[model samples]
Target: MSAITLYTGAMLQGAVITLELTAGATVVSLIAGAAGAVGRLYGPRTLKAFIFGYVETIRGLPAILQLFILYFGLTQFGIDVPAYWAAFIWLCLYGTGYAIEIFRAGLQGIPEGQHEATAALGLTRFEAMRRVIIPQAWVAMLPALTNFVVLELKNTTLVYFIGVQDIMFHARLGVSNSGQPLAIYGIAALIYIVLNGTISRVGGILEKRAAIAS
Candidate 1:
């Protein structure tokens, strides 16, 4: 096979790993963000404080620093996190911080009358949120959430710093072996663009559907 063909194949293999990391991290972060937003808005004071601190701390620290702390610093205390898990965990936490704010804003955007209406109907807070508040907020939140997913997908490249064999890692390897940084790195960039483009497209479709439903 030609050198270009070999490099492309390796990069494709790496893309699969990138997809796995992105999907897992995005799903986890969305769940965490939604929970955190709800807790901050209506939970006990202590829970609110805890979620506030977590969001602040995660947002304050750089993503690379968080990954280093998990992958390397943890070993100092004998925790010994695997590289992949470390990367996955860090992305989830990082994405969740921003996601909380996005979701919180969406939730808070609902008028106070809506809350009163739910209470008047004898709906519990949880029931009201699940059945009424969240659906409205979700439509407003969809665009921001989609942007977060795209950002998370790009951030997956940082996993290579911790030795995850993701797309950028394979691209780097191919460049080192074939001494064609331009072509190899270009291909890697293209792959990321395609992946993110697809995400944005899907997000647009969802947003339109949500708007119509709302």
Candidate 2:
């Protein structure tokens, strides 16, 4: 095959790999984040502290360092995970912290009267949250969480360090093998920009729909 032809396939595969990791991380993070956010919002003092600690700790640390620790340092203790798996785990952890913060912010953005009205209607806290609070919180939080997903998609390139052969990694290989650094890297950049742009557009549409809903 021609150099460009082979490189294109590799690039596509790399993009898929990156998307898979980001998708998995997004799902995991959203669940954990929603749970953590709710925990912080309504849990007792000790539970709130623990949730706060987790979000603070992850947010304070560099994600690259976190990935390295999980991939390299943890492996040294014989708790080894495959490079892709390690990358996936670290990404989930990193994204989860950010999601928690976003959800918390969304939850807080909710009006007090909304919750009060639910309780005034005889709804318990859980029912109020399930049927009233979370849906509205989701709308308020959509912009932030959507932004976070786009960020996670771009940041998936960091997995290259763990030898996951993601988009950046394949782009690097293409540049090295073809001696066309500009072409290879530019292609990767365009792909990422397009992907992120699409996400942002979708987010905008979602926001509009949410505005209509609320």
Candidate 1's C-alpha runs over 4 A off are: none
TM-score of each candidate structure, all chains considered together: 0.94, 0.95
lDDT of 1: 0.90
Compose the digit string of candidate 2's lDDT tens values, residues 92-141: 89998999899999889989999889988999988998899888988988
Prediction RMSDs, each to the true structure:
1.5, 1.5
CA lDDT for candidate 2: 0.88
Q: Rate the local accuracy (lDDT) of all candidates.
A: 0.90, 0.88
Q: List the residue pairs that clash in candidate 2.
A: none
How many clashing pairs does model 1 include?
Answer: 0
lDDT of 1 by residue, 49-74 (tens): 99999999988888888889989998
Alpha carbon lDDT at 165, candidate 2: 88
